[model samples]
Target: MYQYKNNILSIPARLLYQDWSLMSYDTYKKKCDRKQLIRTQQGKGLGNEAFLSYADLPHEIKSVCLDKIGRPEETVVINLLEPFIIPDSKASAFFSNHRTPEGRPLAEPKQRQKSINCWILNAVQLVFEDRGMTGKMFGKRKTRIWQNISEAVNKLDTNKWNHTLPGAAKRLKEKYENYLKEGYGIFIHKGEGNQNTAKIRGEVADFILSHYALPIKLTIPMVLAKYNLRRLEQNWPELAESGLYHWLYEPEQERIWTLARHGKQAWQNKFQHTLSRDKSNWFPNVYWAIDGTKLDWIHFDHTTGHKMASKLRINVLFDVYSEKIIGWSLSETEDHTDHFKAIKMAVKQAECRPYLLTYDNQSGHKMTRMQEFYNDLVALKGGCHHAHRAGAKNNPAEQLFNRFQQQVITKFWFSDGQGIRVKKEDHQPNTDFITAHKHHLKSKEELSPAWEMAVNQWNSGKHPHFEESRDEMYQHPMSLREQLSLQEIMQHLWVTESQKPITYKKEGLTLWLSHTQYQYEVYDGDGNIDIEFRRKYVGKKFIVRYDPDAMDVYIQLCELNAHQEKVFVAFAEPKRKHIDIPVLMQADDKMSWARDYAVRDIEYKRDKTAFEALIARSGYSPSAFIESQELNIKFKGSMPKKQQQKVDAEEDEVLLRM
Candidate 1:
């Protein structure tokens, strides 16, 4: 059926015509083999015998050969497409002799056997197809043919295949016949060696999951104990603790287990999918996040004359866009006062009010006073304020506070580890050492400066989204100014001394606030007592609002609107005291005194002029009445008593008419 010359196997024309129906080998070779359609081998002693490398033949031609020889095309295609290399024939021996550097077999025992089986199947198929032998050719003849094909496969591609084929002739024959009958499935091991023995029954698995996945956080051991008590009654098989653990802690069940055992809040904080907010377009003063956190450092308390029992609270107003600490205050307690100071500082420094303020529902923030300011500021800017639910995990201000604690407080030796959620086992401060060196503890005074330094350092740090530092980003000029005058902002921030209406007096609007007396009088923009304002508004009632720090400057006067809300009227300055001595008088004082004197002199002159005009309007003369009286006296001296009496009577009548 075939011939070999110079070790190149070739198919004879008669066999090709018998198997493939190629009428002329020369014509076929010229049209197909020469064109590389069928791989051809040149043999030195070839004549009428077509030199061919069976392994290198075209797949179609190999399929025809396999069909003629009664072998499946699948196995033939696999063998022809990736024919056995030279190393394959001795693969079993090479694998058995070779060992890893550690002196272990190159492949796992089972895997090695699988590779050998695969090779045995390929080699037997190659022998039948290449040697044109079949199972019908039995005993030594078939064995001899197998030996020849295996030797050739080993001599060809020595570097390509790294496998072993080791089996008796009988075993090889059995595998080959089985492979042809049942295809590739025969190689797949169906033994109990690789079976999953630890898999629990479906009902048992459901019971384990139902008990293990719960909010009470039962450990595997605890869950196992509970299952043990119940499994005996339910006729369940004994379970290994390790297997139970593996089943319960599978990666696929992690989310379900966490949610069930840790509760919704914990799951949300730790595992919920969250999206990042894009704040690239946000500008400073457009959004402000305010929150307070304890400083986590023990400091000396001057008021108590000893080391503080608690940490100081730090209230901060953070510009969300820039992440800048725009304003902050250190206090023994967090209250509306601290919030007021912080917000006031922020507004003052930014020269603008925030368009939106984000805060949590804390006692300090919920004060009617603070809430009103928040509402009024947003109202003025046509923006809105939002109050986050208390203890929310996603508050931006809380994240900022966390960063502050980590980046700032952790730098100090006295800082408490409580500020950080995750800390080294040995990170906590030594209380005994702190107590022994109590004098070294920082006082509120020292901490104040230190806190200020930390704030400056934070503001100087690089911003997350911008190339500049936090302060630089915040200080960058805004495209559109939301600038509010300091006074205007103060109107909202200042506390109301008394909501009850009080009448304005000459001495100004007087009220008792925080155990101190404050007197405010109407003053014009030029710092002069506004006499016209005083005349118009004096004795009228109004509500007073004053800045505690600026009590000497002015107070805001407001009147009740139809809605019973205080509507700002005007600014009333602290009442000015007159300078008794001229030498101590300022220019303004002298001017005020001169205006008062001038007004008095003008009033006196006007009153005298008004008297003369009144006499003329009466249509009577005082000189005429005096002349008549003198004439009557003369007549009494020269004439009779009756004539004198008549003259006196006529004079009296004229006087009465006047």
Candidate 2:
């Protein structure tokens, strides 16, 4: 507590020190050594005799004290005459307990503080005016009071409050007059609803928005300049360019502006609402989605030293369930061949058949040959196929391709990348660096390894729907019914178009294929000929369909249906012949001979059993059949009656021989 007596303030030493240091009692004692303070008992000085001196204190400190208490000289005089009273709150306090006439606290503390400061300066002016201080004296008094207040306000936290200098007396007076007229309501921030006060409004704002929101996307300054020319003709005030800019960029208007400036496709790709799909229940290899995208990388041929601009497209086949890239093929253009190669790779990599294959309806995918190939795949693998419309997002490969491009392709520095719907001119690669490093550019063949590495990395990552890596998820076993051997899948990958009919002979079927004569024997996964196939199609002309890459095995003897579709008949192996000389026979020849003899014995026994069974069923003995055949059953038309009767008698004898 502070006390005034004998023209000296009898302030407690701790109280004075506490106020000066703005610290707790115990902290003041420990950190500042309160016993060493002036007028302390330990110093042998007059204790608690600290008197106030306004001139001795800094200007900022004086101003702050005046706002908190009152003018220094009068405050001291009042303290001496009557007990001093503290203000409801300190000037340095941020949150004021005072409420406005509207029963709401001031919306902005800075605004309230600014109004209070102006009021203080106005009070100083009134005092001078009441005393008849005019001209220089009045000006000096007003300046002095404001300077004191501002200096003290500077000591306080000025961040939240405006630190307006004391020289702006005219502005301060105007603010004080507004406060008197409007009361505390004037301190309420203008941001609450005062944006209606913006200069660009009505027809001018509509004109600017309409012009700016055009697909041309006219600049704000350009629109403003045009509007100003119109205003000059109409004798209306021209709006400032910055004012129009601020209004146009407001949150309420920006969305409409952007949507109109850009097109619907851009809006849909970038800002449209999306629904997430849950694929956790899906099985690997049951559903495959394929799509093609132009790679971001720049490729050029080293031999020709010319860039192959926009010549590369990567067709990717991925398991939609596991999110694993099973296959991908790179080509100079989007063609049916690339799609076929990609499908082939996926089949070989997964070694399984898919139940449903989804692809985009690109021109390459709609080719008659491609359609037939897809039909063949479905027929062999037992699945349906679907082709989505252009720009349809139903294909998972589209999303997977985007992820691969952004996450994997962007890591390569030379990759020329851009966001979706971004103009190429807005985001282009460093052409100068590319030109300087032209020698380092890779050809299509060289770029393949990089693509392979990226695929591997993508497969190695954890799947979003599973707790395992994509490769692990893809490796999980699927139904055996949907599985196929690599050879079986490859057999259907090649087109089954017949070159020419070939005869099925006693040894094998022979055809002139790929500029060479080749013999393929009916294998049926075992020996040259099974009993049923030999009996049904022996000596018949058939078409041979086989994959060139796997010509050693997987030859198919097929028959063409009414629709020109290949109907599989039997699988065959390349015919192998062996020399009969025992001394000259190699190990392979001996093995081949052993297999042939074993298979032939089985076939002979089967045929013999079938022959005997047929004879028994017919109730015919072999001796009886021979005796019956000895009698003549045929007679000439001009033969005598006795001869005819003999012929009839011989027929009866043959019939009765059973």
Candidate 3:
């Protein structure tokens, strides 16, 4: 405390020191005998009446007496204003007396101290405001927070400044920075609902959160712009009217930053490579690894038996530990139905569902149908990077494909790659393997028997490490059955599957999947359009795997963790089949019509040379030919759509008879 009654308080002349030579010698001798005083008694000597003027006061001591006449750091101003800025409940709790367990007020010293501190802070705030200091510099770095706090603490009855100034400044700096970063909410420990947010509160929060989850990335300005626009469109008034944008930017920095930096894939990879896996959890049926492989061996067209195609899809499922191929399906496309059939076959043969099913990031594996099967069978999942991730982390199916390719595919006929390579060397094209086997198989029923023979041979073979065959290894192990009822799991999880690539049109509110254009409209449980539930899902691609047999499938694009993630969220129906027979037939008919019209138009144009030859062959005289030549021109009301050639007078006279 600096004191001023009628005028500024005068300093005592004993506080001023000069004559350093004599003072230093005396201090050196009296160092151990007395205190090392900063100031020495001057010309006043022992006179108690001698008071020095303000000009005579030391600069360091003069600064303490005078309140700084400039703006202080915002944190210092904030600290000063806290007693008034805090809400009513907090103000009461901070200013009130200490409470007992029974809620009775106690006359404790701590309570009296807080009351004094609050009063002192309010007094300091008034002086700072009088000196033109205000809490407006939020962006400015708080450099003088400690100096202001220290000076204010000394004036108050606080022992906070007992430590060294440097140490006190350092601690104060950290505290102020933390307060700025975390917010004034730190002091009161404000919970979520209790905090004050004028701009980003209530519905504004919902709009910001919803927009931020869009698949496309955005900057804070863009998101804020959206917020402003939505408020304006919704006919809500601007938040601050002046500093709304800056106010929103300053407060929700950390939260907005998190949403901005994230991409669509971030959700899927959140815990990808972090968690550890235990291999001791493995068993015969504990984990069944399944994936689709485009088999090297080409398959013949079912009816022709000689029309071989590029490749056939092989959906294989095997016991991971036993290294046995349990079931496989050969199909033209790697579809959900093919995958379901393969897994069903494997489960039925084993008479139990595997506790876990490991799969690859493939179209068939990621399908909603497969996800449903996965949800029913097991919950545990993990994968690791290794030498050629396909063979190592993947199930035995990959290795089985390699072995099957070597023994069967190469023995009969080389694959496309080998065929080309071998043809270049030998100067001869390879014959089809199905050409030899076609005579042996007659129908789809026979095809299964052929595959069964191959599978039986594969299962009966001795294990590479053990004397027991793959079949023996699979049967001997007593693994715990997955708790789900087989019948219930199959009936509940099996959905009639249809899938296609659907593109989201943010503006059009339509999904362009295949050749069909489907709309995304919100529908209620009764399948009626719900006009109130309108949301715009921006640009992103989704595989709409739907139940093909269902009378109607509802599709809506939702957030990444949004419920029903494992199923088709943003939906697609058969916009048009990939190859619609009727549509193709109609297109072909139109093209044929165009070709016939072109031929008829060409035939209708008569040639002058042919007419002259016909007249010569008919034995018409030169007089008759000259008489037959006639000049005529006619005008039509409307011109044709195509450009007409204008006659060149000079060329027409030379080419045609006049």
Q: Which one wins on TM-score?
A: 1
- Each candidate's root-mean-square deviation in Å? 43.7, 39.8, 30.5
The Cα error of candidate 3 at residue 616, in Å, is 89
Off by over 4 Å in 3: 1-236, 239-285, 301-307, 321-324, 327-329, 332-395, 405-473, 485-658
For model 1 the TM-score comes to: 0.39
Relative to the true structure, candidate 2 has a C-alpha RMSD (angstroms) of: 39.8
For candidate 1, the 10 contiguous residues with the lowest summed lDDT are 72-81
lDDT of each: 0.62, 0.59, 0.44
Question: What TM-score, computed on C-alpha atoms, does each candidate reach?
Answer: 0.39, 0.35, 0.32
List the candidates ranked by lDDT, beginning with the highest. 1, 2, 3
Q: Count the backbone clashes (under 3 Å) in each candidate.
A: 4, 2, 0
Q: Relative to the unseen true structure, what is the C-alpha lDDT of residue 137 in candidate 1, on a scale of 0 to 100?
A: 26
Candidate 2 residue pairs that clash? 60-151, 60-152
Best by lDDT: 1
